[model samples]
Target: MEGFDFEKIEKWWVARVKDFFIGKPFKIKMDLSKSVRTLVRGVLSQAERRQKDAGGTAYVGAVMQHLVGAKLELFLDEALEHNGFSVADAPTKRNGDFQIENVVIHVTQTPTESLIQKCVDNLSSNLSPLIVTSHKGAISAENLADAENIADRIDVLEIEQFIATNILEISRFARESRKVTVEQLVEKYNAIIAAHETDPSLSLIIG
Candidate 1:
């Protein structure tokens, strides 16, 4: 520690993230009785509790972002470009969280007026803007869009429902296949977390 340079260590870490190896795969065990949205919210609630315990520094948004990325990759059967949470934190002048074709997808824990403004910008560019957030955030996003007189232009989706509905559709509504679908989701999410986040605590366990 005395001899090592901090700047060199930081540089090494930056390189390490790109080559990070994913270890044992984590699987999501589905609760058959509960709706997919409910299960997804439960996972997020646990993440929120963990965030509160860790001095209240925000990681839930990171979790949501990566989860969305993982879901998209699994659903589309192709990888999506993933950036570290730090890059996501500094979103000034950025178009949206992720862009695919003509759609600009924004993922956030709490939707803000600034985010709505970005959606408006996306519209001006002839791109469809989609806001994916928590159920409460969905309402707030819609309200913000209304204030900007663009409520009908943008699409607002609850994160839980977005992922849950996808899972159901992917599994073809079969109870047995749902567990496997959820497992794939978790596996992809963990891979994204490992490659993008320095903190291993951000990784989701199979439980």
Candidate 2:
């Protein structure tokens, strides 16, 4: 049947749907200790599974971005605010996935030439540019920036490395038992999203 594996794909979707439904109805408080444990487990599990499937790199990349974004929103926002900074989700028309103060973070599964150009555009607009891509894509991103003669102006970081640096406790707990439930993780994530909804600092208005 050519490159098709209907049965395997079906099973994958079924498992994902089941997990979604099973984890949908529960709620928990925003306990950073417990939530970080759950987030680490979930991100690793999802990344491992995605990396093994066809076109898995793209899937893993998207998942990594979401996970990273969640961590930034839930855990790092307070610290940013404390330091007189804030992060906001960038709109599609924006150059990056997130705006952290005057810096724009462009997250990609792979750092293609187009994405690099976007970073350059951000730089021209007087916004600092940060590229976050898969570990394998980090080198390419850096090279592209160099080619564009903007390497010194932009920063490239591997997604995993960023997580490790910003969420050291979670990285350490990734090896431990899964003490937190998926339901709790979802609740914590939702809390972060809800908080952002009314956060004036997160607002991005463009004329």
Candidate 3:
């Protein structure tokens, strides 16, 4: 007679499921962070206000497009995978953006994560989330340690490291993304040169 070993059965079952998905492709699920959504709204509102004051046109669609960095998030997942880390892409409609096996990864550019907590149960949630930012730099370890429910599981990723790690690949991306000619760059240089006339520090950037 065979012994009723529940732990053995569970391990075998889990192994089989994991094995089934080996080498299988995963999709990028839509897991947009709440903080990102709020920041978008704030920026759009500010833009609208500026436009209204200047008597210019306000386009909501354009604001939405700028806020959603779908491409950046996709690239992040690619980088993580390229480094031998299995990444579960963001879900299409889920509030939590992604899952790396059991761990969750949330992408955002906002400095605050309060809003993100509103969309999902962070503490009770089984998966952890990491905030990815392109602008916000040098996050405090304490602040990172304070994320609600996800404090223990949540962390932040800086864009500088992200770009630095994938600089070689990003060079190719930049080449593919070119839409303007040398003329455009020349004009930009001219403008920068004029700006530098008043402030020497403006010369910090050069082609």
Candidate 4:
């Protein structure tokens, strides 16, 4: 007990009790920046809303699209420099959410017949079609691709898997942890949106 500071310990405990009733001081080593946190929180909020009411599916879907689009853009910029290709948000009228060279990437929370058809259309137009959807949607999407006889021509990818793969690649290239790399990419995304107004095709309107 000679080395112990009993009074300091008591004060700390009292402060903790008060904080429990009111609020703790703002102090956190953020894993993500403010803008990125807001974007992620918005997506999570939409997901929660969807859980409460299936009617929020459309809203959640849109948020997922934007989130995926933004992340893909950052990944492409970092990964494609030596590949002679670049990724960008597709126009509203396009069949894909993103375009990379001759490849068209369609991002969805879930795959549907309509999405499959859009991929087929991309193939018909001589563009390589890549479908990025949730892991739960991958199998069904691939089945739809096979049914349409486009499985050989199109690539179906799981969103989480794709992100993991790219994150590893980025971490390797930067010699950093995957989590840190993700935070860096998000910071880059924030800078991009700040420099140029947030690309409408890559941003969601959550009201």
Using lDDT as the measure, the top candidate is 1
Q: Give the clashing residue pairs of candidate 4, or none.
A: none
Poorest 10 consecutive residues of model 4 by lDDT? 79-88
TM-score-best of 3 and 4: 4
lDDT per residue for candidate 1 within 1-207, as digits (tens), equals: 799899999988865653343222223436788788877887787677666645565767888888899999988999888887668524555578788889989999999988888888899999999999988899899999999999999999989888988999999999889878988888898889889888776777666
Candidate 3: residue 10 Cα off by (Å): 74
Model 1 residue runs over 4 Å out of place are: 1-29, 89-94
Please list all clashing residue pairs in model 1, or write none if there are none: none
List, residue by residue over 110-198, the lDDT tens digit for candidate 3.
Answer: 44445355324544556555555544322542264564444455566653344333432533434323212212322332343343233
Two-way TM-score contest, 1 vs 2, winner: 1
**Candidate 2 lDDT by residue in tens digits, 36-139:** 43544445455455455433334344445554566575455442221111232333366577778889887776788988888878988999999877667889
lDDT by residue for model 4 (1-207), tens? 899999999988976765453221111133333333343554445454543444332534554454465567667665321110123334336657667889887877678898888887888888999887776789999898899998899898766566656766766744346557666655554444334443332223222
TM-scores of the models, in the given order? 0.82, 0.56, 0.33, 0.59
Name the weakest run of 10 consecutive residues (lDDT summed) in model 1: 18-27
lDDT of each: 0.81, 0.57, 0.37, 0.58
Q: Considering lDDT, where higher is better, how would the candidates rank from best to worst?
A: 1, 4, 2, 3
